[model samples]
Target: MPFVHIELVAGRTVEQKINLVKEVTEAVVKNTDAPSEKVHVILNEMQPENYAVNGELLSQK
Candidate 1:
Protein backbone atom coordinates (compact mmCIF):
# COMPACT_ATOMS: atom_id res chain seq x y z
CA MET A 1 0.00 0.00 0.00
CA PRO A 2 1.10 3.53 -0.71
CA PHE A 3 0.09 6.49 1.38
CA VAL A 4 0.02 10.03 0.10
CA HIS A 5 -0.53 13.08 2.24
CA ILE A 6 -1.59 16.42 0.83
CA GLU A 7 -2.02 19.62 2.75
CA LEU A 8 -3.74 22.70 1.47
CA VAL A 9 -5.38 25.84 2.73
CA ALA A 10 -9.11 25.22 3.01
CA GLY A 11 -11.51 26.36 0.27
CA ARG A 12 -11.79 23.91 -2.56
CA THR A 13 -14.92 22.37 -4.00
CA VAL A 14 -15.73 18.72 -3.42
CA GLU A 15 -15.48 18.04 -7.13
CA GLN A 16 -11.99 19.53 -7.22
CA LYS A 17 -10.90 17.36 -4.31
CA ILE A 18 -12.37 14.30 -5.94
CA ASN A 19 -10.46 15.02 -9.11
CA LEU A 20 -7.31 15.64 -7.16
CA VAL A 21 -7.45 12.28 -5.38
CA LYS A 22 -8.37 10.51 -8.56
CA GLU A 23 -5.47 12.00 -10.43
CA VAL A 24 -3.12 11.40 -7.55
CA THR A 25 -4.15 7.77 -7.29
CA GLU A 26 -3.51 7.27 -10.98
CA ALA A 27 -0.10 8.85 -10.68
CA VAL A 28 0.82 6.73 -7.69
CA VAL A 29 -0.40 3.62 -9.40
CA LYS A 30 1.60 4.40 -12.49
CA ASN A 31 4.82 5.17 -10.67
CA THR A 32 4.69 2.93 -7.61
CA ASP A 33 2.92 -0.11 -8.97
CA ALA A 34 0.23 0.39 -6.38
CA PRO A 35 -3.33 -0.46 -7.24
CA SER A 36 -5.98 2.25 -6.96
CA GLU A 37 -7.59 0.41 -4.11
CA LYS A 38 -4.32 0.08 -2.25
CA VAL A 39 -3.33 3.68 -2.59
CA HIS A 40 -4.38 5.86 0.29
CA VAL A 41 -4.61 9.61 0.02
CA ILE A 42 -5.00 11.89 3.02
CA LEU A 43 -6.07 15.46 2.57
CA ASN A 44 -5.31 17.89 5.35
CA GLU A 45 -7.22 21.08 4.91
CA MET A 46 -6.09 23.93 7.09
CA GLN A 47 -7.97 27.08 7.84
CA PRO A 48 -6.45 30.39 6.83
CA GLU A 49 -6.17 31.38 10.46
CA ASN A 50 -4.24 28.21 11.22
CA TYR A 51 -1.71 28.55 8.44
CA ALA A 52 1.13 31.03 8.24
CA VAL A 53 3.79 32.29 5.87
CA ASN A 54 6.65 34.66 6.51
CA GLY A 55 5.53 35.00 10.09
CA GLU A 56 2.14 36.24 8.95
CA LEU A 57 -1.12 34.35 9.22
CA LEU A 58 -2.83 33.48 5.97
CA SER A 59 -6.06 34.97 7.24
CA GLN A 60 -4.38 38.32 7.60
CA LYS A 61 -2.88 38.31 4.17
Candidate 2:
Protein backbone atom coordinates (compact mmCIF):
# COMPACT_ATOMS: atom_id res chain seq x y z
CA MET A 1 0.00 0.00 0.00
CA PRO A 2 1.12 3.53 -0.74
CA PHE A 3 -0.16 6.70 0.88
CA VAL A 4 0.55 10.03 -0.75
CA HIS A 5 -0.11 13.39 0.87
CA ILE A 6 -0.29 16.58 -1.20
CA GLU A 7 -0.65 20.10 0.15
CA LEU A 8 -1.21 23.19 -1.90
CA VAL A 9 -2.97 26.52 -2.00
CA ALA A 10 -6.71 26.31 -2.41
CA GLY A 11 -8.69 27.32 -5.52
CA ARG A 12 -8.02 24.64 -8.08
CA THR A 13 -10.89 23.43 -10.23
CA VAL A 14 -12.32 19.93 -9.84
CA GLU A 15 -10.87 18.82 -13.18
CA GLN A 16 -7.38 19.77 -12.11
CA LYS A 17 -7.66 17.81 -8.90
CA ILE A 18 -9.03 14.82 -10.74
CA ASN A 19 -6.12 14.81 -13.17
CA LEU A 20 -3.64 15.30 -10.34
CA VAL A 21 -4.94 12.36 -8.38
CA LYS A 22 -5.07 10.14 -11.41
CA GLU A 23 -1.57 11.00 -12.53
CA VAL A 24 -0.21 10.67 -9.01
CA THR A 25 -1.80 7.29 -8.62
CA GLU A 26 -0.33 6.13 -11.89
CA ALA A 27 3.12 7.25 -10.83
CA VAL A 28 2.92 5.58 -7.46
CA VAL A 29 1.61 2.40 -8.95
CA LYS A 30 4.39 2.31 -11.53
CA ASN A 31 7.20 3.17 -9.14
CA THR A 32 6.24 1.17 -6.06
CA ASP A 33 4.28 -1.64 -7.62
CA ALA A 34 1.42 -0.70 -5.36
CA PRO A 35 -1.97 -1.95 -6.35
CA SER A 36 -4.16 0.81 -7.70
CA GLU A 37 -6.86 -0.16 -5.24
CA LYS A 38 -4.47 -0.03 -2.29
CA VAL A 39 -2.89 3.29 -3.09
CA HIS A 40 -4.24 6.30 -1.22
CA VAL A 41 -3.88 9.98 -1.96
CA ILE A 42 -4.85 12.82 0.33
CA LEU A 43 -5.04 16.40 -0.78
CA ASN A 44 -4.80 19.24 1.70
CA GLU A 45 -5.82 22.67 0.53
CA MET A 46 -4.83 25.66 2.63
CA GLN A 47 -6.30 29.10 2.48
CA PRO A 48 -3.91 31.93 1.61
CA GLU A 49 -4.48 33.48 5.03
CA ASN A 50 -3.34 30.30 6.70
CA TYR A 51 0.03 30.14 4.98
CA ALA A 52 2.99 32.45 5.49
CA VAL A 53 6.47 33.17 4.24
CA ASN A 54 9.14 35.69 5.26
CA GLY A 55 7.09 36.66 8.28
CA GLU A 56 4.21 37.70 6.08
CA LEU A 57 0.96 35.88 5.56
CA LEU A 58 0.29 34.70 2.01
CA SER A 59 -2.96 36.62 2.02
CA GLN A 60 -1.03 39.77 2.83
CA LYS A 61 1.37 39.22 -0.01
Candidate 3:
Protein backbone atom coordinates (compact mmCIF):
# COMPACT_ATOMS: atom_id res chain seq x y z
CA MET A 1 0.00 0.00 0.00
CA PRO A 2 1.10 3.53 -0.69
CA PHE A 3 0.17 6.51 1.41
CA VAL A 4 0.32 9.82 -0.40
CA HIS A 5 -0.11 13.09 1.39
CA ILE A 6 -0.79 16.33 -0.44
CA GLU A 7 -0.84 19.72 1.20
CA LEU A 8 -2.07 22.90 -0.40
CA VAL A 9 -3.66 26.23 0.40
CA ALA A 10 -7.40 26.07 0.78
CA GLY A 11 -9.92 26.94 -1.96
CA ARG A 12 -9.20 24.34 -4.58
CA THR A 13 -12.18 23.20 -6.63
CA VAL A 14 -13.55 19.69 -6.18
CA GLU A 15 -12.59 18.79 -9.73
CA GLN A 16 -9.00 19.83 -9.14
CA LYS A 17 -8.74 17.78 -5.97
CA ILE A 18 -10.33 14.79 -7.63
CA ASN A 19 -7.90 14.96 -10.52
CA LEU A 20 -4.99 15.23 -8.12
CA VAL A 21 -6.09 12.12 -6.21
CA LYS A 22 -6.64 10.17 -9.40
CA GLU A 23 -3.25 11.02 -10.85
CA VAL A 24 -1.40 10.42 -7.62
CA THR A 25 -3.01 7.05 -7.09
CA GLU A 26 -2.27 6.07 -10.66
CA ALA A 27 1.38 6.96 -10.24
CA VAL A 28 1.72 4.88 -7.09
CA VAL A 29 -0.04 1.96 -8.68
CA LYS A 30 2.14 2.15 -11.79
CA ASN A 31 5.58 2.70 -10.32
CA THR A 32 5.24 1.30 -6.81
CA ASP A 33 3.27 -1.73 -7.93
CA ALA A 34 0.60 -0.91 -5.41
CA PRO A 35 -2.93 -1.91 -6.17
CA SER A 36 -5.16 0.94 -7.21
CA GLU A 37 -7.42 0.13 -4.30
CA LYS A 38 -4.49 0.03 -1.93
CA VAL A 39 -3.24 3.50 -2.81
CA HIS A 40 -4.25 6.02 -0.16
CA VAL A 41 -4.39 9.72 -0.91
CA ILE A 42 -4.72 12.30 1.80
CA LEU A 43 -5.30 15.97 1.09
CA ASN A 44 -4.69 18.54 3.76
CA GLU A 45 -6.03 21.94 2.92
CA MET A 46 -4.97 24.77 5.16
CA GLN A 47 -5.93 28.41 5.33
CA PRO A 48 -3.38 30.91 4.07
CA GLU A 49 -2.89 32.16 7.59
CA ASN A 50 -1.95 28.66 8.71
CA TYR A 51 0.74 28.23 6.08
CA ALA A 52 3.99 30.17 5.82
CA VAL A 53 6.86 30.40 3.37
CA ASN A 54 10.19 32.17 4.02
CA GLY A 55 8.82 33.27 7.40
CA GLU A 56 6.04 35.18 5.63
CA LEU A 57 2.48 34.06 6.07
CA LEU A 58 0.74 33.03 2.90
CA SER A 59 -2.15 35.36 3.54
CA GLN A 60 0.24 38.26 3.89
CA LYS A 61 1.98 37.45 0.66
Better of 2 and 3 by lDDT: 2
lDDT of 1 at 33: 84
Which consecutive 10 residues in model 2 have the weakest lDDT in total?
1-10
Clashing pairs in 2: none
Reference-based TM-score of each model: 0.94, 0.93, 0.93
Clashing pairs in 1: none
Candidate-wise lDDT, in order: 0.95, 0.95, 0.90
Residue lDDT tens for model 2, 1-61 = 6899999999999999999999999999999988999999999999999999899999998
Give the C-alpha miss distance for residue 29 in model 3, angstroms: 0.5
Q: After superposition, which runs of candidate 1 have C-alpha atoms over 4 Å from their true positions?
A: none
lDDT of 1 by residue, 1-61 (tens): 7999999998999999999999999999999887789999999999999999999999998
* C-alpha-based local distance difference test score of model 1: 0.95
lDDT (Cα, 0-100) at 39 in candidate 1: 96
